[model samples]
Target: MKKIRWLPSQQDSHNRWVVFFSLLMGVLLDSISWSGDWGVAIPDVTPLILLYWVMAIATNNFLVTAFFFGLLHDVLYHTGMGTYALIYCFLLYPMLHLRLQIRNKTLVQMSLFIGVWMLAHQVLVWLITPANHLAMENIAFWFAIPISILLWSFIFLSLRVLRRNMNVR
Candidate 1:
């Protein structure tokens, strides 16, 4: 097996407030889209932000934050208790392993990671969502993937800037 070089960018990043605010922004955005009466596609903000943080900063720390955000998302969105928490927490395993592998410095790579994760997350959401929520069948939910893919670059770049500003590792 080839020994891959993991970049030392994490060593340069260490802004706790940025991490907190970025994750917080993600959850807030998700909630706004969930509760708002918007008629268009809204990207799944949580995972996208989570992916960036996991890839760009401290991957291990995010698992705990993911669980909390998941619970917060569950309660705020009313998608049923533990649903969002479980999904967010469940996603961390992949994120942890994929951390160094996914270099978000490039748009294509970021798109690939975002697309795959969103697809998996949505598919799982479809399967695991409680029966009661099944009633709202078409949520323009299908647009989630493409929208998220398109937004990944913007979010990635924005977070890159945020990371730079905060100096988070």
Candidate 2:
């Protein structure tokens, strides 16, 4: 039997490929997040259900990641091509700046990040979408924020565990 390599030995190289695939996956998932008609009252849960937590925290260059994924989102959804890119850069700026405050905080920190990320995404979408198309009751969807956060926690924790096992800093 071949010996299995430790996570540290393979993480860096594997991380690069994971980032590439994630960009594609992020766009595809976000498109699904936007599809389908809203019926009388129930809130759409896709965005909350499809949170795209990066697999490794160390790969967190929010601007670069955001720009790439946003571009993919725009291309796939056929929206203002660069709009999401700009919004993502703007949204990620604050997150990156506050990185230290969030670093070691525990699951609560991840939960807070999810709420903030969802809020940032919602605000940007609202700001960019034409006022004529606004849906008044879309506000009910904010309740989905917690769900997205819970989803994010799982991904974030998995990445953390993988990184720790690999001795990646």
Candidate 3:
């Protein structure tokens, strides 16, 4: 008989890669600014949040991770430093606690989470940036939510399948 022992260090190294990829994805998502009207580029479709949520589900401690990513988002988007920080803390914490209740979560779940998450993010932005009245005018920009959800679902599931296939003895 043969036995194999798992190493905590190996898992930690893997987690480091995951964090790096998540951060990169967040930055990439934030960088995509397309013109909407009057040369005003609408900044929507936050893949960072999608990746953050997926990472939270895959790993433990969703709140802490979400908070950190939220801070990163604030820095990148040049919004109030704690706007997304607080939102991520509020939305993802309960999600972590109640994750077990989400049975058979599929792409549909990803789509739904994206829609809800975008709506909540927009609301928080509105609350924090009252001077930016245009924010509300463009709330329909949230229609991008479903596309982000689908993209995230593909990325998340593909990565999961790849990892499972690569598991070595």
Candidate 4:
């Protein structure tokens, strides 16, 4: 079996700012958290981006990226402080640890992982949401897990392409 890589893969020689811009795209995408349909729990794009970088790049800086993104996520989305920051870290740590096992897998398999991740996030959100006075009444939130799984391939591909095109580590 291939041993896990705790460090990031080889990176571009220059232009590290591209990585920051790419991550910013994710935080910006979080604005779409709300979907008009009541039955569709929108996939949290920030976590998707966070998981991707933690897995694809495996950089030491990933945690800091997650922290900043998560903080920005909460502020932009108007949720509680440290809410998404904690959630991002929660998902990031595991993905980083498991990256070796799953790195070679196809997107379909990765979607299964994303599905479980989404469920876990929802559970935690349900537990902590009341602190922010948020109500989880929408029937669509139930649909989020499957929707995120189904969309995982697209999201993964898109982010991967962006990462590659930008030559980001």
Indicate which candidate wins on lDDT.
1
Comparing 2 with 3 on lDDT, the higher-scoring candidate is 3
Positional deviation of 162 in candidate 2, in angstroms? Answer: 5.4
lDDT of 2 by residue, 89-120 (tens): 77667666665566556777657776777777
Q: How much lDDT does each candidate structure score?
A: 0.74, 0.56, 0.57, 0.73
Model 3 residue 99 distance off true place after TM-score fit, in angstroms = 1.9
Number of colliding residue pairs in model 2: 0
Candidate that beats the other on lDDT, 3 or 4, i.e. the better one: 4
TM-score: which is higher, 2 or 3? 3
Model 4 clashing-pair count: 1
Which parts of model 3 have CA positions greater than 4 angstroms off? Answer: 1-8, 38-59, 161-169
- Candidate 3, residues 21-82, lDDT tens digits: the string is 65566567667665654222233434334344444445555555666777877887687887
**Candidate with better TM-score, 1 vs 3:** 1
For model 2, name the residue pairs that clash: none
How many pairs of residues collide in each model?
5, 0, 0, 1
Give me the runs in candidate 2 sitting further than 4 Å from their true place.
Answer: 1-14, 33-60, 131-133, 161-169
Q: Give me the displacement of residue 100 in model 2, in angstroms.
A: 1.9
Give per-residue CA lDDT, model 4, range 45-160, as digits (tens). 66776677667765454787788888897788677899878887887788878987776888789899889888887777667656423336665666778988997788789878
Q: Give me candidate 4's TM-score against the actual structure.
A: 0.80
